[model samples]
Target: MKYIKIRIPKATVYFTPVEIEKLLNKNIEITNKLLTQQTEIFKEGLKRGKCFIRSSKQKIREERKI
Candidate 1:
């Protein structure tokens, strides 16, 4: 199979291409763990950035209203 699907927490839809699997000797566990960790970090950073932007915009709108 060129691609393999893994079922992991917040990583159920992850697909590893054969090239990477071969590089890791067909060990998908490490790949999934690394991917999930990276995904979590990215999501957290995005959430924090978006929340800050939204709050700033809301403050601007409120200032205009008053």
Candidate 2:
């Protein structure tokens, strides 16, 4: 038997400002902070994924030249 391990990125959708105000009626300041944090997380994840992909491509090129 063979085993394969895969990593799947997970995501969560946050409430839009209108929805937050209408439904939850949370403070605007807090909601803005939460949204900012979520955006930062997404940006960081993208950076990591791009770096990994670039490194993998480089390794493949290096291997082929050998």
Candidate 3:
């Protein structure tokens, strides 16, 4: 048997290449869409006062919960 490994911020998981490719493609598609409409997205978020950040402690807590 063969394996593929993915290292996320707080966790690692193994997947088959096909699964990884699918995930990668999906993420790329979503990212591209977001970029195309980034201004509108930002405007909407600003209107709602919503935002996100990369938080290590939050990642650690989520990983521990998982």
The CA lDDT at 56 in model 1 is: 100
Each model's TM-score? 0.51, 0.59, 0.47
Tens-digit lDDT track of model 3 for 1-66 = 567987999999999888878999999999999897998888888866533443656788899999
Sorted by TM-score (best first), the order is: 2, 1, 3
Better of 1 and 3 by TM-score: 1
Candidate 2: residue pairs that collide: none
* Backbone collisions counted per model: 0, 0, 0
For candidate 2, the per-residue lDDT at 3 reads 31
- Model 1, residue 43: what's the lDDT? 100
The local distance difference test score of each candidate is 0.82, 0.77, 0.82
Arranged by lDDT, best first: 3, 1, 2
- Cα lDDT over the full model 2: 0.77
Q: What is the C-alpha lDDT profile of model 1 across 1-66, one tens digit per residue?
A: 445667778666545685655767646777888999999999999999999999999999999999
